[model samples]
Target: MTEHLGTDGKNHLQRLASLRRPLAAIALCCSVAVSLQGCVEMMVGGAVMGSLAATDRRTFGAQTEDKTIVFKGESRVSKLIGEAGHVNVNSFNRKVLLTGEVRDEAMKAAVEREINAIENVASVVNELEIAGVSSFSSRSNDTLITGKVKAAFVDAKDLFANSIKVVTERGNVYLMGLVTQTEGARAAEVTRNVGGVQKVIKVFDYITEDELRQLSTTQDKQTAR
Candidate 1:
């Protein structure tokens, strides 16, 4: 006989199912890479990375700079808070988003200040809550929710999944990317409907339809080469 699942168990299983599609796609990519001949490995690797860079709206230089900002920002925040609070730093196109928790408003402001000082950080969005550190179980749930939202984006064939970045803290979903106004709105609508999403916050840098068309053209040219 099959065992029955409680409401929580059912929800957990559903979340797992939501994540399976993207994970499976990744696995398939890995399998294909492994099956390729060693002679073509470098070519295939370059192609994959090129495809990803094309899909992202930021210039290649900006992408590298964003990585540097996140790494440095995280280190600075850690030194300041140091076991006293939780912090997550995400950088996109030189703009930083700060989430997680801090003990007081003072620390929250301090964290934002430090992030702003990081080289190449154009601006900072301070979403750090003034509360005690979140428990591990809560954080795990947040991770699951983030994955589900990403899967939902991938399932939405209308959107370019790589164009948007999803971040979850507690139950709130934060989306950051460079997208057209219509794309940003549609992404928020899709994310709002996902399970366990209490709220959806859009941090998108909007572009004109003409700008989007230009980006598409540029990406197509890069992909062709």
Candidate 2:
């Protein structure tokens, strides 16, 4: 499926066109939910929701440069749905990845349809598993791992953790960051060594030396401050 998103341009367009309405519906439902729940609750909801949305964009863009182009197209369509802070969206080429909890099946299907409507989306990966809101302990674990992983990269020579985003869910570590081949190997090794990590899946975009240098500089500043 991912390979298709990378090589096949025509299929991507077909998928995006199919997804628009569903995604718009997701945005609508979220907007309504926030209005009913009030600002305080909405803010709390945004924290996790925002991460899911951002992770999708960051992960897909880092995975493939071609997919990044597809993502931009899909994002523009979603923007029209307005900024509903609850639902999260991710797209790679025409493959749309949806995650995070929603209130009902209608919302789920709506999001899936909207993503399918985009011009270049090859397919929609509807991983928006119906589940309750995230718990405090889960969020804390995510924060701890992100901070620790980013910190580890700072001290490790030639390794940049900022290029990697750490997502800890149910003790499993989902690593989404860009890195050079060597840096990725190092990051994987470090993740395995981390206590409480059930597993680490390396989802990274391998970059050239020049890109690595830029990332390294950015990482240095992050580590310093």
Candidate 3:
């Protein structure tokens, strides 16, 4: 009788362990969904995020460094600007983009100068407008436009959607990517068509078609793995 009870206990534990795996997976999906903030972007970006390390034009090391640069640069810039200036900092492949409004030309120049001094920053594009800080509604609209631009890219079969990072500020759209001239032009053209986009700035690290082909292979290998 004791032996029979031990066998049943083991079976019960095995079943519980089996249940935990699926439960854990569901929990993880929920966590990612919540963290991504937009279910649609998350769904659309799922493929991109999965293959980000593989398919990125920047090498894995460059991608990590770019993220680090953005984190440190944003912290420093936000502190420097205070409430006087509304600044948004974006770092892609070590190049920093400064948008939003500053008090004057001095504040604008200062934002660039400060970010430029950061280590590993290749360059700073200061597109900070001199007008008054934008209202909440304006910024919200910019967010909507950014989502639309990204969704448009996902549907744009001619271009790789994940290759570009889209930023919209005050009706102007800025694109950052490591792509070829053709890809950049294609991306800009797509953005220009998005409603409420006033201007497009291409900040691209142009590569040859051969280089692009080499990068494309990475995704295949990643998938096979």
Q: What is the C-alpha lDDT of each candidate?
A: 0.93, 0.60, 0.86
Q: What is the per-residue lDDT of model 1 for residues 53-148, given as tens digits with 9 covering 90 to 100?
A: 899999889999999999999999999999999999999989899999999999999999999888888999999999999999999999999999
TM-score of each: 0.81, 0.44, 0.76
How far off is model 1, as Cα RMSD? 17.6
Best-to-worst order by lDDT is 1, 3, 2
Please report how far candidate 1 places residue 129 from its true position, in Å: 0.4
Question: Which has the greatest lDDT?
Answer: 1
Q: Model 2, range 109-163, lDDT digits (tens) per residue?
A: 8767766765556565565546665667876886687577667666676664444
Once superposed on the true structure, which residue ranges of model 2 sit more than 4 Å away at CA?
Answer: 1-99, 102-127, 208-225
Best by TM-score: 1
- Could you tell me which residue pairs clash in candidate 3? none
* Ranking of all predicted structures according to TM-score, beginning with the best and ending with the worst: 1, 3, 2
Judge candidate 3 against the unseen true structure and give its global Cα lDDT, from 0 to 1.
0.86
Candidate 1 segments exceeding 4 Å error: 1-42
lDDT computed for candidate 1: 0.93
- Candidate 3 residues 1-225, lDDT tens each? 436668779888889999999999999999998887787777879867776656567777778888888888778878988899888888888888889999989888888888888888998888899989899999999999999999889889888877888989987899998899899999999999988888988878788999888877876776788
